[model samples]
Target: MYVIHLRYTGALAEIDDALDAHRLYLEQQFDAGAFIIAGPKIPCDGGIILAATMDRDRLDAIIAKDPFSQQRLVHYDIIEFNATRLAPGLNLPQSS
Candidate 1:
């Protein structure tokens, strides 16, 4: 699993301008089953994304195309972890 944290580096106006493209990018990722969960962080300063297990390089490439990234409006932090445990009925991404 991976946790993708995005911290805005530019002004909120810039972030807002890129929001639509960012959302569309997320929606496409979800459609492709790349994302498990995603949303804005508390206080709305940035965003968080939970992604399926996969190659870190691939994930990085995908994130590099995010509108925020393209516009250089945010910084990305990726954390990878093993899913050693899960709640009942919760399914995780299959390892590639």
Candidate 2:
């Protein structure tokens, strides 16, 4: 598993226009099981974190399609890390 850290660095004016498309893209990725989790940073800091259990190439392609990336509303610094999953009552699937 890996985490993609995205930092938005642009005018806030573009947010309303880009948010919907960005969300749609993420939804598609989630449904495809490529994205395990994703959400925006609170406090309106223009940051987002995405947990992906797929290859960097595929993830890169996915991000490339986001409205934020396409419209220069945000930029990303991807970090590939080792993830460990532990749970008790949660029935989450094992990480690939």
Candidate 3:
């Protein structure tokens, strides 16, 4: 799997406009089973984490479509993970 770290860098005024588009993209990815979970960072850190498909190319494409990226509101770092364990309720897939 992969974890995407999105760090917002633009004006807060654009948040409401960008949020809906971001959520829409995430919802579509989730429905396609390519996304596991996503949410904003607490403490207003201007960041978000997204658990996404394992494929880097696919992840790149998905990130490219994010409103934050389109609007130059945020930058992202993609981290690939090898799931060795998962806690209940996290809904992560069992490692093969």
Candidate 4:
């Protein structure tokens, strides 16, 4: 799985201006099964996205398509890790 941290690069005004498009991008990714969960950061300066395991190249391509990237509104840091433990109700792809 992956943890994507998004930090605002542009001003609040610019971020707000791109919110709609950014949301649409998120919706698309969710629909495509690329994202598991996503939401804004508590301080409202950034956001987080939990994505399903996938090829690194593919994930990078997906991230590149985010509206925030296109608009230069945010910076992203992606972390990939092996999920050694899962909660009772959690379901995710397993590593061989």
TM-score of each candidate?
A: 0.95, 0.82, 0.82, 0.93
Off by over 4 Å in 2: 91-96
Where model 1 places Cα greater than 4 Å from the true spot, the runs are none
Candidate 1: Cα lDDT at 16: 88
Candidate 4 C-alpha lDDT tens digits along 19-80:
99999999999888899899999999899999988999999999999889988888999999
Highest TM-score: which candidate? 1
Q: Is candidate 1 or 2 superior in lDDT?
A: 1
lDDT of 2 by residue, 27-55 (tens): 88788777777787786756655565666
| Residue-by-residue lDDT tens digits, candidate 1, 1-96 | 899999999999999898999999999999888899999999998999999999888898889889899999998888999989999999877865
In the range 25-96, model 3's lDDT, one tens digit per residue, is: 888877777777778788664665556445677777777887889898987877887776778777665322
Q: Is candidate 2 or candidate 3 better by lDDT?
A: 3
Please, what's the RMSD in Å of model 4?
Answer: 1.9
Error of 3 at 25 (Å): 1.1
Candidate ordering by lDDT (highest first)? 1, 4, 3, 2
Indicate whether candidate 1 or candidate 4 has the larger TM-score. 1
TM-score of 1: 0.95
Cα RMSD for candidates in order: 0.8, 2.1, 2.5, 1.9
Kindly indicate the candidate among 1 and 3 with the higher lDDT: 1
